[model samples]
Target: MADGPTINTIAERAGVSIASVSRVLNGLPTRQETVRKVMAAADELGYVRNAVARSLKSRRTHQVAFAMADVGNPAYLAMLREIQPVLKAAGYRLVLHSTDAVAADEIDVLHSLGERYVDGLIMSPLRVTEAHLRMLATARAPVVIIGSVPEGTRVDNVRADSRTGVRLAVDHLYALGRRRIAMINGPLDTVPGAARGAAYREALHDLGLPYDESLVQIGDFYRPEGARAVAALLDRVPDVDALMCANDLIALGALDVLRAAGKRVPEDVAVVGMDDTDLAAASWPSLTSVSLGSAERGKAAAELLLERLRGDAGEPRVVTVPPRLAVRASTAGPDYDRRQSGYDGEGGGK
Candidate 1:
C-alpha cells in the first residue's frame, strides 16, 4: 500500500520548517513567499490537511446540525434540498437528526447543543414547549429555528404563513362555486394544525359560508390517518364538493379515498393540498397545491445561521415566506380553458 505524504514531508520538500507548513495549512497568517512554497510542495506531494487535528486546534468543527421533526416528510426533504447547497457554499458541513416529531427527542437534541460537536444548530421542533424555550434561551451556540418560536424570543426564525395558505385554498374552492368544502386537517394540538384549523374557519366566514363542525375531520398528518379522516368527512357530509387537505400527504390520501369511492377529480369534487410537494405532481390527476415556501424557508434559515456564525450578531429576525397557489389537473378539469377572454380583433365590426 502506498503511504500518504505527511506535513513533515511537505515541509522538507518546500525547504521550510514544519511550523511554517502547519501555519499555512491552518489558514494562519503567513508570509507570501512561505505560503507559496507550502502550496507548491503540497500540490506536488498531494498533501491533504488533517481536518480532525485542525478542528481540535481551532476548537471549531465547521459542522452544523439540522434537527427536524420528521425526515420522512416531503416538506422536510424540500428544505434539505435548499439547505444543503447554501451550507456547502458557506464552507459548513451538515449533520441531520430526525426527531420523529417527538417532544422528548427534540429536547434531547437541544441539550446536545452543549456538546460543541457542531458550530451551530438549525431545528424545526414540532412542538415548542416551555422546555424548548429554556433550551433556546441559554443555547451555547447560535440557533436558527425553522418554525414559529415564541414571539419576542431572541432567536432567528423562519416561518410559513399557513393562515394565508389556508385562505388561498378556501378562496380557490369558493371561486369554483363549491360551498360545502370539507377539511381533512391534522391534530389541532400541533402548531401547523392549530393555525390551519383557525384559518379554515376564518376563510369560510369571510366567504359567507357557514363553518360546519360536522364537515371537519382531524387526522394525525399521516397517510392512513388522512384516509380515515376523509372517510369520516364523507360520511358526515356526503354532499361535500371540495376537499381542502392540510398537507400534500393528507391530500394524496384524500385522493385515494375519492378514487376508491369512484368519484372523478375536479368534476364531481375538486381537491386542493398544501406544501406543493412532489407527491402532488405524481398523483393520478396531479393535485393542485399551495406552496408554503418550504424550500425558501430552509434557505433563509441556513442563511440566518451562517450570518450568526460569521458574527453578525444582529437582532433576532423573523422571516415570513409568502404562499402561492398552484393549479393543476386535480383542480382544473381536462377541458378547462387556459386563455382569458378579451378582444380577439373581431370587435364591433360590421
Candidate 2:
C-alpha cells in the first residue's frame, strides 16, 4: 500500500482535474458522468482513500463528522449546507451520519469519539439523555452540539429559539383574527416538539384565547404523517380558522389537505409553520413561517468546533440564534390580492 496510486494518478487516468478527483473521492456533489469516470479509474488503479496514513503522519486528520437526526428534513439539510462549506473552506473534509432520531444511535455516535477516526464532530441529537452527557464528558475529540444541552455540559453549543419561534408563528395567527386556531405538532417527547407545543399553549393564554384540547394533533415530522394528522384534525374541527404547524414539512402537508378539502388558504383557514425552510416559498400561496436561523446555527456550530480544534483554551461557549418571522401569502392580510402578488414558488428563502 506504500506504493499506492495518488490522486494525481487517478486524475491523469480519469482525464479530469486533480480537484475533480478529490471531490469525487471525498463524496462531494458531482455530475454522474464525472463520478462514473473517476470510479472506473480508481477501480483500475486499486486506489483507496488514505485517511489512516494521513491521520498518522499529521496527528490531525483534517477531517470532521456531522451527526444529526434525519437527512430528509430540510432544516437539517439547511444546517448541512452551511456546515459543509465552512469546514470545506477550513480545509476539513466532512463525514455525515443520520441517526434516525434515535437516542441509542446518537449515543453510539458520541461513543465513537474514542476511535479518533476524525479530528472532531458536530452532532445534533434529537433527544439528549444521561448517556449522552456521560459520553460527552469523556469524549476524546472536540464536539459541537447543534441542539440545546443542559447547563454545565462543558461543550460548545448552538441552539435555536424554538419557544420564541413558535410564539412568533402563533402570534402572527392571532393577530390575523384567527380564533379557534389548531396545532399540528410532532412527538411531544422530543426537544423541539415539547418546546413548540408548550409555547403554542402559552401564546394562546397570552392572547386570552381558550386553549382547546381538541385542537391539537400529534404526528411524526415528515409529510405523510403530517397529512394524516391534518386530515384527522379537519374531521374533528371542521370550523377551525387557523393552523399552526410545527415545521415547514408539516405545513406543506396541511396545505395539501386544505387545498383538497376546498379550503382557501388565508380565507377559510390561515396557516403558519415553523422552520422557514425553502419549501415554504415553494408551496402554493407560499407559506408564512418562523425562522429559527438553521443556517446561522450551522455556521456557528462549525466555527465553534473549529475554534476548539485550533486549541482555544477558553471555557465552553453557548450560542443561541435569534428567530425571525417570514410572512408570505399563507397568512396574507385581508387586502392581499393573489392575482397581483402571485409567486412562482421558486425561492422560499430558507
Candidate 3:
C-alpha cells in the first residue's frame, strides 16, 4: 500500500484472522503461534500501528499527565523520578505541567482533563481553591491528587504529613538543645506553608518554648527568598540558636547566610529543613531535614491512577505517608561522618 503497511496487510501475510492480528499488535494476550506469526508478518511487512486510530477505538490514549507546583523544585523532582519509571513500565507516556504554584494555572490544568489528550492525571497543587475543588469533583478523567484536600473529595489522594514533618524536625532540634528556634517558612497562603507554619508553632508550644513573633519570617519557597527571610530573621533575632526551614531550598539559603555571617553549623546555630531532597545531602554541612516521602507519594499516586484506569469502582482512596527525621552534620556536628546518611527513627536510611 502506498500509504504504508497496516494490520490488514499483516493479517494477509500471516494468513491469520484480522482479530488475531489486532490482539497481537495491541499487546493483548494471544496464542503463542498466533503472536509469533503476527510478529513475523508485521516485521516482514514493516507494519506500524497508528496510535491515534488505536486510541480512538480503545478510548484510551495510554498517556498520563502529572501537574505540579514547580518542576524545578527538588521535592517535586524526586516525585518525578519515581513517577516517570512507573508510568513508563505501564506503557503510558508522561505529560508534565508546571503550574508555578499559581491557583489559576492549576485550575487550567484541571480543566484540560476534558481534552482527552491524557487518560489520567496526577496533580500536586500548592493552593487548592474552591475552583480547584469544583473542577476536581467533576474531572472528566481519573485523577490522583498529591496534596491535602478536604475530607470526602472524590478522587485518589496521596498526601504528605507536613505537619508531622515539621514536628519531627523541630523535635530533633529541640532535643539537641536548640532553645532559640526560629522558623523560616513560605507564605501562609499555600497548603504546605499553612500546615508547616502552624505545626512549627504547635511544636514549640508542646515543648514549652515561647512562640516569639520575631522568630517567624515568611517568604516564598525559593533559595533567594529563603536567604532574604533568614537574613531578616537574623537581623531581628541574631541569637536564634536553631532554624526550622520549610524546605530544602530554604535550608540551603539559611546555610548560605550563616556561612557568610561566620556562624558555624550545628555549633553557633543548628539548621533543619523539610523535604529531605537530594540537595540536602549535597549542601555543605549536609542538611538535617524531614523526609515526607516525596518518591513514595508519587509512586502511590501513579498506582492509584492506574487502578482507576483499570476500572476500579471502589470508593476513592487516600494514602498518607508518614514523615521521618534525617539527622546529618548540619545538626549532628562535624564529628558525625558526612558520608554516612541519616535514618528515619524506624531504622530506615534517608
Candidate 4:
C-alpha cells in the first residue's frame, strides 16, 4: 500500500522543493506565493498533517482545552464565545470539557494534561478544592483558572470581582428603598456561592440593614432550584420586597415564581441577579443584573495561556475583571408593564 501524503508529496505536486514545503507547513516565514502554492497543492491532494508525529517533534499539539462547570450555562457560553476566536486567531483549535462543577472531574482533566493531548487548558471550576491547588501547582501544561483561587498560586488567574458585583446589586436595591431584601443563593460550598453570600451580608450591613437568617435561601444554581428557593422564601417572608439572586438563571426562576404568584416586579418585589447573561435582558421584564465580565475573563484567560505557550516564564499574573450593574425593567423601569403585558398575568411566561 502507498503511504499517505507528506511534505515530499506536497512539494512534488506543487513543483516546489521539499525544504520549501516544510517551511510552509511549519508556518515559518516564506514567500506568499510559495505558501499559496504549497497549501493549494496540499488541499488538492487531501493532505492532513500527522498530529502525533508533529507533537513528538515539536512538543505541541496546537490544541487547547477549556473546562467549565456547564457548557450550556450562558455565562460559560459567553466565555467560550470569546475564548474560541482568540485561540483560533493564534493558530490553535479548542476542545471543550464539562466538569459539572465536580471536583473529581476537574482533577481528572488536570491529570489528563500529562498525556499532552493539548498544549494548555483554561478551566472554570466552581469549587477550588485542595486537590485542585495541588494539581495546579504541578500541572504538566499551562493552566489559566477563570475563578477565584488561593493567594500566590503559581498559575495565571482570571477572576470576576463578584464580591463587588453582589455589592453593586445590593446597593442598587437599597437605593430603590428595598429594605426587606432577601437573597436567593446557590450552595454555600462553592467559591462563588460563598463569596456572594458574604458580600450580600456585608452590603446589607453597610446599608444599616440587619442580616436576617430567614431572608437567605440556599439552592443550586439552576432555574428550577431557584424557583423552589424563591417559592419557599415567598411563603416564609411574604413581605420581602427585593431578591438578590446568585446568578441569572436563578433570577429567571424568581421571575417565573413571582409572576406565578401574581406579584408585580419592581412594584411588589424587585429582582436583581448576578452574571448579567443574555437571559437577563431577554426575560419578560428584562432582569437587572451584575456584569461579572465573563467574556472579558475568557479573553484574558486565553491570552494568558497563549503567553505561557509562547515560552513566557514570568511570574504568575492575576487579572480581576471589574463588575458593573446592568439595570433593566425588573428593578426600575416605567415601561415594563406596557412592553411585556403579555406576561403580566398569573402563571405567565412560566
The clash number for model 2 is 0
Per-residue lDDT over 1-350 for candidate 3, one digit per residue giving the tens place of the 0 to 100 score = 89878778889999999998887666554554675687668657765335423433466657788999888999999999999898889898898888888899888877866545578999999888889999998998899999999887888999999999998888898898889999999989898999999999999999999999999999889999999999999998899999999999999999999999999998999999989999998888888999999999999999999899889989999999999998989999875643365544455666
Tens-digit per-residue lDDT, 59-161, candidate 2: 6557798998989899999999999999999999898889999999888777756544577999998688889999999888899999889899998999999
What's the best-to-worst order under lDDT? 4, 3, 2, 1
RMSD after Cα superposition, model 1: 10.0
Cα lDDT tens digits for candidate 1, 55-127 = 3346665778899988999999999999999999988889898988898888877775654557789999767
Model 4, range 1-350, lDDT digits (tens) per residue? 07767777888999999998786666555554675687668767766345323533465658899999998899999999999999999999898999899899999999867655578999999999999999999998999999999898888999999999999999999999889999999999999999999999999999999999999999989999999999999999999999999999999999999999999998999999999999998887899999999999999999999999999999999999999999989998646644455554555652
Q: Could you estimate the TM-score for every candidate?
A: 0.80, 0.80, 0.81, 0.81
Any runs in candidate 3 off by more than 4 Å, and if so which?
Answer: 1-58, 338-350
Regions more than 4 Å wrong, model 2: 1-58, 333-350
Model 4 TM-score is 0.81
Residue 39 error, candidate 4, Å: 31
**Model 4: runs farther than 4 Å from truth?**
1-57, 334-350
Query: Which has the greatest lDDT?
Result: 4
The order of the candidates by TM-score, greatest first, is 4, 3, 2, 1
For candidate 1, give the lDDT.
Answer: 0.85
